[model samples]
Target: MFRFLPLPEGALCLIAATAFCAEYLLFYFHSTSHKGLEGYYHLILVLLIGLCVVSSVAGALLPTSFPVDLTNGIAITLQGLWFYQTAFSLYGPMMPDGCQLTGDQIACGSAASRVRGELLANFQLFSLVLGVLVAVVVSYGYAASRHGRS
Candidate 1:
């Protein structure tokens, strides 16, 4: 069944990254404003989108090397986690105990809570990386075995 899909691994990664990029762009445009941390998030989102575009081109041009696939996997996972962080931190109940959303910006009541939120974001990124790594490895292994190369 999987044989019907003929895209190379890198191309697959690029497709996923592109999807995330589109979603991020939509969110960025729809948001109230880009100021303070919101601006920072928008900047990061733009950077991530650029990375995805470059990676996608590399993947299409050099499908044999796995570096593009790995990079895209990491970037896409980070983008996903970052989106979650932004959603929760700015608009959801996950806002830290001392933080309040103030007209498209987050105002933390204390530095401690802000630090905690940052720590949690780090942990989320780490967890997403781990999960993406495992999935990539497993998928690569399966593909290789199916092709009878390893």
Candidate 2:
């Protein structure tokens, strides 16, 4: 809707929230058929997408809130990071032991290995989030020291 390009101020956030909401629904429902490690990863992704949806809506309500904006950014960042982690772990060289790419599906030889893979996925997502938060905090401190409110 190009006609609605210049949406009234905070309306932009609501629009973004709507988009994120639609994405979350698509992924959440579609993920039911994903199966195994793939399903678990998709579930994590869907949850993060839901977070983005919530944050965007919050941003609409609190347009000037820095924390709301930061939450939205971090959620989006984590979602993107998780996608990359999935690509590398499930489809790239980092595939867990006892798992193999058979045709187009990841086939783990045992339930334990699949569980291991899922835990690894969770750890990777957590690590990415921790790294981003640390970076943000460090940068904020640097900026505060040099250019923040005197």
Candidate 3:
């Protein structure tokens, strides 16, 4: 199935898989720690997983006419991936600021939040790498597809 798909499509699939693994591992470790406000972190992780799924599907369906207009399916999918990465990971640290939890709960919450931040940073890194790979693949695919035909 992937044989005919553009390189960007395959790369996005790999990126999505990588993101899911990171999310799952991060949550698994946090959950086992009996941390506070773990529910919120888990919720965010679930959202990331959803984003990954969307990216993979959209990339697969991206038209040959994409990388032309600004509203292409592939562009939308890439934007979604960027938004998810930036909003969730880089912004995760501030999401739990000034919590109402007290004592041990507060400590646990802060620690849990830090774990989330670390995970977010890692996710963003992977996203950035994936974005670059997608660009490269798309550029090459576009040029290759157009060569000798135009």
Candidate 4:
């Protein structure tokens, strides 16, 4: 009954990107205020939504291009990791002690903590890129072997 469980790579990427876009939009609208660096979070969400839109369109239009497919995967993964980082840094348990939520604004008592957060985000992005690369290579190899092409 579930015939499309293994959707084509492009379709899967398109769906994932669309989902992330919807989620980010919802978060943007639900927020009570954007003060100080809070606005930056909203900006990140907007930027990610734009990236997802591009990735979705590219995935749909250039499904056969390995580079396009790889980009889509990387973009989607990055968006997810960024969402996690934003959530934890802004409202979750990972929030540093130097940061406090005042009304709608998150004030960091130490600039170093904020800088550390940014560096952590960079690390998250790098790790996701490596993971996506490995997954893509393995999937491509599997597909090739299954099709008896290599």
The residue pairs in collision within model 2 are none
lDDT-sorted candidate list, best first: 2, 4, 1, 3
- TM-scores of the candidates in the order shown: 0.58, 0.91, 0.32, 0.60
lDDT of the candidates, in the order given: 0.66, 0.88, 0.52, 0.69
lDDT for model 2, please.
0.88
Error of 2 at 141 (Å): 1.2
Top candidate, metric lDDT? 2
Q: Candidate 4: which pairs clash?
A: none
By lDDT, the better pick of 1 and 2 is: 2
User: Would you list the rank order by TM-score, best first?
Assistant: 2, 4, 1, 3
Candidate 4 Cα outliers beyond 4 Å, as residue runs:
1-37, 60-66, 145-148
For candidate 3, the per-residue lDDT at 80 reads: 53
User: Which stretches of model 3 miss by more than 4 angstroms?
Assistant: 1-9, 32-36, 61-150
**Residue-by-residue lDDT tens digits, candidate 3, 1-150:** 567865653465456556655765665566465444444444545555555555554544653424432233344454456555545432344344434345434333467666665564456556665876688679878988989365
Question: Which candidate has the top score in TM-score?
Answer: 2
* Runs in model 2 lying further than 4 Å from the true structure: 1-6
Candidate 3 vs 4: which has more TM-score: 4
Query: Least lDDT summed over 10 consecutive residues: which range in candidate 4?
Result: 30-39
Q: Candidate 1, which ten residues in sequence have the lowest lDDT sum? A: 32-41
Question: What's the lDDT for residue 84 in model 2?
Answer: 87
lDDT per residue, candidate 2, 14-60, as tens digits?
98999998898898888888788888888888988988999999999
> lDDT, candidate 3, residue 32?
63
